[model samples]
Target: MINTHTNAQDLSSWQQKYPGVSEITTDYSEHYQISINKNNQLVITQDNYEESMIITDKGTGFSAVESIVFSDLFRIKSYEAYTLNNVNGRQKKTEVAHIADKKLDRQSVFDSDVKLKTFNFANLTTGSKKVLKYEMEFIDPFLLHRFMFATSAVNEKRTLKISYPETVKIDYKLFNIDKNNLEIQTETKKGITTITFQKQNPVVVKQDSEAAGIMYEAPHLHFWISEYQTKNQTHPVLGSIDKLYAYYHTFISKINQTENQELKNFTLDLIKDCKTNEEKVKTIFKWVQKNIKYVAFESGYEGFIPREAALVYERKFGDCKDMASIITEMAKYANVPNVNFTWIGTRELPYTYQQLPAPAIDNHMIATYINNNELIYLDATNATVPFGLPSSFIQGKEALIAQGNSYIISLVPEVKSNLNTIHDKIELSLIDKKIVGKGTFDANGLAAAQYRSIIGDNLLKRKDFAFALLEKGNNKFKLIDFKEIDFDNSEKPYSIDYNFELDNYLVNSGNETYLNLTLDKPYQNDSFEPTRSQTFDHEFLQKKSYQVVLEIPSGHSVTYLPESTTFSNDLLAYQFSYSQENSKVYLNYDVEVKQTLIKPKQFALWNESLKKLKENYLETIIIKQHEKN
Candidate 1:
């Protein structure tokens, strides 16, 4: 008989060889069998198996507490877990003792039909292996199927199999499969077709670090029921973009458009004083942004259908769909003719309707008003966003607008870096061992809007917030006195005049003084990791400029000045200059982040730019005392 000690030792040796991996997936398989009964109702039975070995304590213990998520569309058949451990001279197997079932209502602020089934294995420890087996049935055929091979842990073996009757025609697509070594096999026997996908020793992918969506990083498959055949007829489900749009339009059409007299009068009153159409639209848009509180409600049909416009107006709070409905309806009542309902996806998704043609492509709804052939997307969910600008989350994304019986797809423009500017000017003099300065900080465009939002209602905490925003050098830097100008007026740029002092900022040796002139180094350590596999997303472009004028003391003279430097690339640009004239040292620094995305291939160039920026921050200005004659 084989000794169990030797088996454990072999397993331990394999784990030691790959020390970076905390857990290993020994086996993962998903089998889906589909059939249509005599009543023409589609039935899908799924069997799943997941086996993993705990190599280390890092990420292994969490696997013992297994949780399975299911919705109203699925029914659990069976679930079980077994723990295999080496005890004394033989392998011992112990089954899970307890199982828990609970409603997953707290997963989000919205109500949901999803539920969770959880079970904890017994005696989970390092060098132990756990196996989870479960089966479920799909209550609806339209739920489709999605499978992924890559996981957080390194998977040694994975398999996905789908068997269905020939009467049902299913279409499938593979995403990000070319980057991995996955095998596909298909076999047909006696009016039944079977497809299998397998992967061996797949590399672990970190989803959080990826720039693109999960669909772009992991090897996954999306299978949908395209059509089904009966004795002498065929029926079509959702197979094309038109079909998908038709299905979506059904939900939108269900929205009760009955005009409420109170809502219409309220909208009219809000925009009565506006002079132009533009002003009227802005008034209505701002009113919705200020009044409607966004609370998402995604439970079954509520997830797809929007509440009535009048109901939403009365509720004072609604989700994205309700907000969009109220805004669109209010715009009509306000006599804004060009406004339309729009659908879009956030930055987290990398899909286009033309490519995926599914409901998963878009997750948000808004209102768009066109003036002079230019579209202004309004999302009331973001209360802080300005009237004419699209929300930051939907920038550079495609928008689907409702147009009579048809729809128009247009791309939302990306805001440029120069539009979001932060300009600062400061004049200071060294006194004793501290540096005292007074400067004006000016913000424009989105920067100004963001500042106003941050400083809202918290006037008492403005000093602390300003200090956090503008403090430079070291922890000893203190905000002395400050005055905010034009901050309450959103039409003008937000400006703050602040007086500050920095202690222990200057190094003195006898009569010579050394000071590192680089203040407010924003991107000091913003380099991308070398092992990063995905592109980086910055979300928004930004431009910052700083000017500092340092007054020379009564008897001090400039001894050395570092050379001016400039760095520029497609992703970022920087310029630093320094000059001394008439008892004053002037420093000008400007940087522009050109794009919001940094591709993986540009990591090296980006790191090089950051390195130069860091080196420039280390340059020092030397001041020497003048000798008395």
Candidate 2:
């Protein structure tokens, strides 16, 4: 028998190729078969999966556990596991056990029908392999999930093959795969088109903190049955954006056909005092956001279709789709013209409807009010989000808005850095080798949302959260007192006035004293790895301004002060200035994050910028003792 494990020299080469990985999939395959069901719906008939994993490091035993995740759309049929041990250079099959089978814990996020099926190898030495085999039967398949050849570990050889009748027209697009570099082959057999995507030793990128989603970097294939043909007719499924919209409309066409008297009465009564259309609509939308709880309820067909508006109002809780329905109904009832249900993908999904035109392209639903050329997005799921501002996650995304039977695609406006801002004004004084300061931190837009999420509803723990937000000067920072203003109002900016003291923060060597005045150094420890192939994405654009005035101790002479430094690039901008006038020292620092993505080519520039910033952090204002106080 041929040896499947890598040799001693090849083992080190594999390790070098895939850093931070001790195991890899030597052989993995996904074989899919599709056909038309009784309802004439394009469905996946069978899905067969096989995987063989081997340990590259001898120090750690191969206890590889195979996890099979499935949802209500699919049913697990068979599962098998085996441990193949390399005893005396000969392969031997050991135990077989399916360890775990249970529903996934869906805490606070959603109630899901997804489940997990897992099997594991107890303990196999180096060069030993673990094999897993499983099959699934699709109940109703709408979107074909993308297949990623690149995983968390290296894939020595991974294959995905789908077989369907020639009548069904399927389309697939490759992402981030260099066909010229990989050994790609295509062969047609028995008059059916055979396309092969073969890559050799595909290594997944090492993970970094706050990196973009894998969909943006992984070598994957997005395949969907665009349409199918019967003997007499051809049906369009998702061949074009219009076709996808048509299909999506069918789900909500029958919803809210009959209005609930209770809902209408409540909405009319709630908006009785509101004279203007905008005011009435805002009041109704806020009522839904405040009363109805948002729980993502996902099952088979329930995941795609929205419940009736009356039913959702009766239950007082629904998923994104359901909340959108009630919001639309109530707004329309309250004389808000042109209120419609909208579909959009959040920032996490970085693809547009034109790119894929599949349900997989969008994961969320909201409500939109359109008049003439203006578009207002209403996401009731976000209870505290302001009326005019779209949620931070959905900003700058393509929205599919409903218009009768047809639809229009529009991009959500991105909030600028200045809108979501944090501005600080602080005054500091040195006393007994310690620093004492009083300041007020003001935040607006998404910047305020960040602090609100941390503060939560715990009144007792709010002070500790405030301290953490303003913490600086190592862990010795202390918060003496704090008071908040306008925190409960979503439409207004919030402020926190605080008194803080830092013990022994100043460095005193004999007569010379050193101090760095910059606090809240955002992204100081963050940098895209020099070798990282992926881009770094920030969730939102932000601007921070820090103005601190320090009083120099009496009888102390200013010996040195750090000069003004500034750096500006496409993605970020920074400015730092230090000045001394009389006995008062001032620092005016500002940072504006212009864009979300830092491309791979800009890694060196980004790293250099961070390096300079850190060096400036080391630069301190030096004070010489002219005379003892």
Candidate 3:
């Protein structure tokens, strides 16, 4: 049996049981010549820089020590020091040297019962190569949370020196490094630093150190590191996979022994009420959604599968995994067709289930499928989301569908992008040097789902929110009324009307106040900045309609009016019109996007249209205040 314990004595005993294991011995010392400059990039090097060294050793079968030695050239965001004691929740600690001498209280960040503790700085010499050393008495038994040793001294170069006893194998994974500016020279057979510069700024640094034991009998151990510049060079600590698994097993065992039986029975019985499979499926979905709330619990093992289906059902609340498990069970009992449990990430990801070996491909979710074909991704935490459309986040992702023991099916979906759509009408009056107008705005299709997901079930509040959004501009404004807001679970489109008053939305110092007729809708902007520097490629099914009737103040003449503009691209379609007669100006605008994906080649064109529309909105209305007297 595998023994998973973090206690020194427990680990010591376990190590003695395994013979022929490679003794763990590591000596890692690195130097840095660091200084801050204008670009805010850390410049570090070994020969002329500050230095640090750490020596860690562990006999065969025992977790090995991790140590560090350093000089003060490292300008860290924050410093936290720890000295081990036999207190209630205290873990290990290092001998204090450069910073203040103190022991740190240890508990996971998400541990509500634990007091929050912080360290401001560390003890070390301020000059180059001023060595400070810290030794780990024993191999750390527990997994360290997200804490990685890192520093970002503006405009400095950096280097690392690591030495192992040639007993343990090592592997390093690097991400977000500028390959053009980096070079590596090492004695170890397979120790190398990798770099990726996808985006233009703030290079991301990542490294993974792993030790492989004998094949199936022994588990592989690894230490992961990631560094980036934060306000104070601070990073959150997350535990390792082995430690997490152990913590999860312990928690699940405890939770299983105690759960709500009535809630379980209620959920089980709820499935029975469905007259048909479809109804049963829908009903079960509704039950889970109404009962379970989405709460992320990534502290230690809390990130794993929940305690039990019965307990989660009784509580009516759980993380994504918990809710998914419960729904899976209910679906099984109700005979709502054949369904499998699966994993999925939100929409921002481009990974597929076929890439299951990529451990970090997904973080949350469980997909329910019918006869191993049609699929419905469910997220119980999003209580207000309608059936069919998973929250926009998980719209396109890979899902690990359970098939049988050691057999899981990988599922991926075609991208389901939200289309741009806006319908609006405005009534306007020219007053003094400004133009006052009231208008109504509406939405449909994926655009409606996006709004509903955010607004939830509070229809009145949702309407008020829309009105408030439309009230923004360079002028003082107010929304007096709204109408025709409705949601249809069965229909592909949902609609809403928002009414409001605008003041000085557009103006000039002259005799005329010009108003641009392009309507700004909620779906106009996509919030993703890709690293590859590629332009947006997804096409949007977009539509915009607006009608504005301007009541010009008596004796005021129109100076300049914008000619109607219209255009269409592989990814978009648009039209606009303006007319003047007597004391009223009539303006109508319509925009519709016909595609779902936009290629990089078309991004420049899309940007041009967007710029033109924004310019139209910025065009001011110039009204002569009293006709210049």
Candidate 4:
């Protein structure tokens, strides 16, 4: 039997309070029990999780959804869910049928053993509720799960409990958790210890545009077993950086155990003519970047281990770890000293080894070269990034470098805004009712690398890509011909010289014609929302300068010009200048984004700086017929 007795007023109040929210978790609980396995390795013997949520929106009321992704290291023991109806302010539960357990191969020229388990609470109505319970077994103790206090949606009540025997020791790190809201209790009894974390409500989750990653924003707990005690002796798990490194060493120790003469000869032949160590490293790095294509694939523990160097070399394709392996082996074969195999986490995971010395903290691997105490990170997965600079995603991240029995942590340097620049110069002329121009554009550093990566070697996409980036004026603007497109030499900027015409860019009224001299305006209407809570992210720092010299039409005089303004502030610096000499009028626009994260506190300044540019973009230049004396 089924019954429906809903409270309209309560549902309406909830709907008004949390608009656009489809579901709200009323309660979520997770419990874990750790114990020693037959092999003396610590394992999660019992892992249980449950979540109960109420439907807040009519659309989502029809169906509630949940999923679990598992790899070889973790397996799901059981899963059950039920849809509960609001009957007389009480709950009546009905079983949810057809739980889907299937393999989902993430294929993009790659294969893996990862699988997905999903179920939906179908036929749910507004004000209805749902409950789900599941159990998971951790095959590997080192790869434990991090418990997040809440999702993007509102969480009313949440609890997490972990139980372990007296022989096991555990350590934890808390991120973005407020001490005021969190209630922690620890107790030991009957030769066992249990810890619990309870919270009524966390922060109001706000999904800001371009917000930092969830790991950086969410309140979460990451825990690991530091060590375990046995009747005979003690076994270390991951107490220090050295222990983590030692565990990682097991995966790569027997990788290239046998000689790889083919890879060695190939590497030797590739760098035979290189005279300097820098040259050798650059040569090897470029070879891997150009040759080996990156493909992600993981199976069992192979996800953490790098395959043999020779195997990857022969295949001509590998993932990040494999690429790191080859880059390291090749550099060593060429007699490059102080080469280190490195582990790093991209900006998405904002944790250092000292903060959480666990395998889960790092998601990427690279090869680093040390010279005069300067760490040169080489990430061959980025085919366009040059040797001296790291890929933008890893900037400001700590690199865990392997140096024989010990590890060194180094910070990847951030590229200066000036280094990654865009300087374009154009000479414009007023043709028959149109604007015609010949321009030369230069993009340096990471900007150049980004262009190269996008344009690649495809001759067909080059022109269209260039047009998309350089398109300005009006819809009828046309790119006539590319005089030059050079991306070969890393020493120089990625430069392009072309001729173009803006068909309807200028407005004319009798003898007077109007033109917006800030032709290539960037960051127009780029403003942060008032409701934004997190820091804004920029893919890379930028420095852009656009210059144009318009030849005064014959027998015409400048009647109106926008005032020039120049100012520099902490968030950004901008300049709009106009100068006239002889028969040509010059206009220059410059802007530099000085920092990566535009903090909420700097929103006003950031928006104001861009507002000035937007205001100038509306200002126009007027050319009137010269008055006869």
Highest lDDT model number = 4
lDDT of 3 at 175: 26
Which regions of candidate 2 are displaced past 4 Å? 1-22, 36-43, 56-61, 85-95, 121-127, 181-191, 509-513, 553-562, 579-583, 622-629
> How do these models rank on lDDT, best leading?
4, 1, 2, 3
Q: Where in model 3 is the C-alpha error above 4 Å?
A: 1-118, 122-182, 185-276, 347-356, 406-422, 427-439, 444-464, 483-499, 505-513, 519-563, 568-574, 577-609, 615-629
- Index of the highest-TM-score prediction: 4
Q: Against the true structure, what is each candidate's TM-score?
A: 0.90, 0.90, 0.57, 0.92
User: Over the full model, what C-alpha lDDT does candidate 3 score relative to the true structure?
Assistant: 0.45
Query: Which residue runs does candidate 4 get wrong by more than 4 Å?
Result: 1-20, 53-64, 86-93, 104-109, 204-206, 457-460, 488-492, 560-564
Tens-digit per-residue lDDT, 531-557, candidate 3: 223324232245667677778777666
C-alpha lDDT (0 to 100) for residue 68 of candidate 2? 82
lDDT of 4 by residue, 1-629 (tens): 12344467766776776677777776778888887867777778544555544545543443366777876778888777778876777777877755786777556527677888878776576677676777888887788888888676677767888999989989998888866668999999898899999887756667776765677667888889999988778889986888899988877777766768999999899999999998999999998988999997777887889988899999999988899889888888999998778899988787888889899889888989998777899998899887798998898889998887787889988899999999999999987878899999999989999888887779878789889877877689799987545587664788889899988788889889888888787778578878776777776888999999999988898988788988788878888888889889999988888888776788888888888768778989899977667
When summed lDDT is taken over every stretch of 10 residues in candidate 2, the lowest stretch is 53-62
Candidate that beats the other on TM-score, 2 or 4, i.e. the better one? 4
Clashing pairs in model 1, backbone N/Cα/C closer than 3 A? none
**What TM-score does candidate 2 get on C-alpha atoms?**
0.90
lDDT of 1 by residue, 150-184 (tens): 87677887899999998888877777775346788
Residue 206 of model 3 has an lDDT of: 22
The best-first sequence of candidates by TM-score reads: 4, 2, 1, 3
| lDDT, residue 175, candidate 4 | 89
Decoy 4 TM-score against native: 0.92
